[model samples]
Target: MTASSVPSSSASPARIPRRKPRAARIGLFGVGYHVYWGQFPGLLDELLAKLAVLERRVAATGATVVNFGMVD
Candidate 1:
């Protein structure tokens, strides 16, 4: 059959609804010895600071970040 002779449907195309993706939950933790903190003086502070930077980066991704802090 010729293109001009073909029949066309009057109905419009259906559109699928879109949904937002769920946020992710992330947990962060660090480990350090108390003895090392005393020996190194600023070791604990430096480690905590680094952990904070990591937490900020993760949270920026629309995720819930929980920092458990230094573990022993």
Candidate 2:
């Protein structure tokens, strides 16, 4: 059986520690550009707006905003 076919409670899973990148700044972006969601300009606008706020929020937490990744 494939992994997805296994019963949820039947197996012990390995937990990997999520090591955060040591870069001074990181920008997270959605997959809208590569998908049909980017067809509408409004979609990109909204994405940029949200990313801008997110960058500020992350920067407030001490991490720098290298780029919001919203290129239009």
Candidate 3:
């Protein structure tokens, strides 16, 4: 089939990129984080940092992140 046959530019099979995986909501609070017994302060910081990086990667693909589940 010729290109003209396609009705719209977005008609291409691969025109749009696939969505990214939803950010894992660690806690039910919706802050995108959580805590565990015996967990140290440093560990939480690491986790938050990782979450931030994950958010950036997903955003780069032109997709919406699911949510930021956290607890107070």
Candidate 4:
């Protein structure tokens, strides 16, 4: 059918309804090799310290943070 043939009301685009925002949940995980801690001094402490900084930053965003500490 030609464009002119269609009704003007039907030709207009449909509007979408706005949705409410949802709360955010953030998950954090880290991994490390067990052997490296023995070989390199302070490696474990360093990693944990970094992760702690990250956790604070993520939490600052007002989202719930679930931090799963490092695993060997």
Candidate 5:
């Protein structure tokens, strides 16, 4: 059989199936000693600053970061 004899269905332009949209929800939390804040002096601020940087980096990767910082 020649190429012309082939059925058109094999080469037909059927609508391509589309995939559904993907969604992801992520929660990011940090922990530290709340009681030590007074004794440590600036410990709370240090830990929070670090957590903020981490959250920013993670968010940059397209992930939704729910910051639950300073868990007492």
Candidate 6:
């Protein structure tokens, strides 16, 4: 017990307070193949506009999006 008396507030180390992360239930799906949309005539509106821009970028990150569009 001799390393400069060992008494610097127990060498300072104790801080745990972090818990705020639980909002993600994303389930987007896109499978276009509806008989080739009459030989590629706008291909089913471009695959439903790219699945609505990937469901608006995954519902802007505060997720809970369930887009099951173009499921052919």
Highest TM-score among the candidates is held by which one?
A: 1
lDDT of 6 by residue, 1-72 (tens): 997887787566886766976678988888877788888899888888989998998898779899877787
Position 64, candidate 4: lDDT = 91
For model 5, state the Cα shift of residue 18 in Å.
5.3
Mark the regions of model 3 whose C-alpha exceeds 4 Å error after superposition.
Answer: 1-39
lDDT of 3 by residue, 1-72 (tens): 898886886555755655975554332122423455245657666666677777777667766665463433
lDDT of candidate 4 over 1-72, digit per residue (tens): 999887898466886766965568998877899999999999999999999899999999988999999989
Q: Select the stronger candidate by lDDT from 2 and 3.
A: 2
Q: Candidates 3 and 5: which is better by lDDT?
A: 5
lDDT of 1 at 62: 90
Best by lDDT: 1
lDDT tens per residue, model 2, 1-72: 899887899568996876975556676764465464556657766777888788788888777767638543
Tens digits of per-residue lDDT for model 5, 1-72: 998988887586877676965455568777877789899998888888998999899888777889888886
The CA lDDT of each predicted structure is 0.91, 0.70, 0.56, 0.90, 0.82, 0.84
My TM-score estimates for the predictions, one after another, are 0.70, 0.46, 0.41, 0.68, 0.65, 0.39
**In model 3, what are the clashing residue pairs, if there are any?**
30-68, 30-69, 30-70, 31-68, 31-69, 31-70, 32-68, 32-69
Candidate 3 lDDT trough over 10 residues, lowest sum: 24-33
Q: Backbone clashes per model, in order?
A: 0, 0, 8, 0, 0, 0
| Order of the predicted models by lDDT, top scorer first | 1, 4, 6, 5, 2, 3
Reference-based lDDT, residue 42, model 1: 85
What is the Cα-based TM-score of model 4?
0.68
Q: Which sections of candidate 5 miss by over 4 Å?
A: 1-19
lDDT for each residue of candidate 1 in 18-42, tens digit (9 for 90 to 100): 6976779999999988889888988
Question: Which of the two candidates, 1 or 5, achieves a greater TM-score against the reference?
Answer: 1
Off by over 4 Å in 4: 1-21
